[model samples]
Target: MLNFFLVNRLSSQVRILSSLLVMLLVFILVTVLVKVDTSTWTMEFFALSLVCVAILSGASNVLTASVFGVTGRFPLQHSQSLISGQAMGGTVSALAAILDLTIASNVTDSALAYFLTADVFILLCIAAYLLLPKITYSRFFGLFSYYMNLPDEPTDSSSSEDPVETVDVSSSKTNSPPIIPILKKVKVLAACLFYTFFISIIIFPTISAGIESVEKYTGSIWTNKYFTPLTCFLVYNFADWSGRQITTWIQVPGPNSKMLPVLVFLRTFFIPLFMFCNYQPRKHMYEVFFKSDIYPIIFITLLGMSNGYLGTLSMVYGPKVVPKELSEGTAIVMSFFLGLGLAIGSAFSSVVHLI
Candidate 1:
């Protein structure tokens, strides 16, 4: 909700750069405070650090909304690029965790390296945003400009008295235009997005993380330590990234196609697949139908792939379906649906874990 408001209030570049700057400051402060000795003021510093973390977390959604708004202006292929980049970040994080696990011995040293690396990355992003306007295509597309509305076009110039009809890009503009009509335009894409993420999040990290190798008792480091990270996180993230990249070249089942929703709803089957994997410490469900490691690797990979493909397709198609003026609003609405799906999925995941 805050994201929707902030995106409209500020330009895309401004909001993103501002958020990145704040995050950079928070990171520096946290690094300084947490490294200090544990004195009477330790708790005070810790509390302050938590508050800073919360602020950064709160600003994250706004940053996301702003970026999506910019991409919403351009062609759908650009949106696919942004989606692919996001998935690539996840893949990189998974790999970095594996690297940290292999090399870092002390938790303090590991955390220090982690936060410092993040700070540098934020700086890089800030620089990138500063340089984005230099791109010819970005300028040509007016990516930074807010589209108020498209000019009215007449169907027949000779027959009509006034060929080009006047559009009410009103002088007395409200904070936003009528939302009901906009909602009606992107309703199907929104639903597809919600269900896709809902299915993806319901089983991921909760049930999937608990899944163990069938050869757990083998006692090898590969099976005990590296198996889940490699097969689960790394593979899923890589496949997801691949799926997003594929959208740039091949966006099958077109924007208005009915097959899109059918394919999205079919992803619900992945939930049961993950649940039925070799989940450890099986308390309630006695059966583990997928008895081999290969099953989980395949299942998790497919889950991530489908999630990336369908999720990206749905989001890119959102702005395309609406009028130029309403693209920003529809983009924000699509983001809301995506978040709503994640929220609902997170809530359901807890229930699945308990059961």
Candidate 2:
């Protein structure tokens, strides 16, 4: 029942939600149609296509991450790089939507199957790229550097300090280092993981179920479920773009702004909820689910918009909670939590369908 076309006024939060909604709706509908006949394709052919898409998407995510990381780390012109990276990420999302839609409509059975597979592959690839080697190195080094610099620790007496200055090296050693405050770090990591896990639990299952319902009732298959990925991609991008705009332009009076965190949390929760509510199972739901199709489409659009805004805000503000040096590391940990959450959600959703 959500109004799909209503353009909400632009707050930092609203701007994100609106964009996600618009992009997702367009991409999901178009992809669904394109994927309709892909069941006719051979699995081997389909898989090859998927691999190609995965490589492309993975490369894009890595490039975006690298740009952002390098820019953030640089002493000079960090802001410009950061902005450029975010913009690029947003552009990727937009491009993905367009490609998915175009491919969905014009592609033949074999072609559609290959395309869908590729999209999924790309998604997984992006995730893998985000998770592997560099994540660990960045996180460990960042945390290590932070902990090594704690003010609580006294200078080592062996190096040379006056007698008064040399006092109580033992107490200083017992005190945690200044750079990465262990307690704060733990709390942030825990919060990120917990939120990611729960949200994933809600989202993945709902999406899988929705796809299954579409397949079962509509007589579609995996390839025809292109809408799922398209919707996700668009929503993520739109929310991200909006968040960047909000944070950049809207400044609060105080040194610490309450708006950022509040907006970020709102962005995070709304998209999943929007998706869930739209696809909520009803009696004979499959029979009636696509009768109008309009309702779900609207939901998809809204979900995308919300996601776009929230994602962007989270990316921008995520590092601020920790030290500058540890930003990349924090991002890696957060990405891990996100991946784990998505995996668990997908598994659980599949199980629910079997039941």
TM-score of each: 0.89, 0.43
lDDT of each: 0.80, 0.42
Best by lDDT: 1
**TM-score of candidate 2 relative to the true fold:** 0.43
Residues 239-344, model 1: lDDT tens digits? 8999899898888998889999999999988877887888976778889898889999999889999999999999999888765655766788888899899989
Lowest summed lDDT across 10 adjacent residues in model 1 is found at 162-171
How many angstroms is residue 76 displaced in model 1 relative to the true structure, after the best TM-score fit? 1.6
lDDT of 2 by residue, 1-355 (tens): 0111111111112322333344334334434656555466668547855764555444333344333433333332343335435545655755655665666664466455544654564455445434432455534434223223333222344664433223342343332123234224434443434443444345533652353233335556423555555444454445435534554554332223455345434535533333443354533333332434444445544444443333433444444454443444344444444445556656665544332
How far off is residue 256 in model 1, in Å?
Answer: 1.6
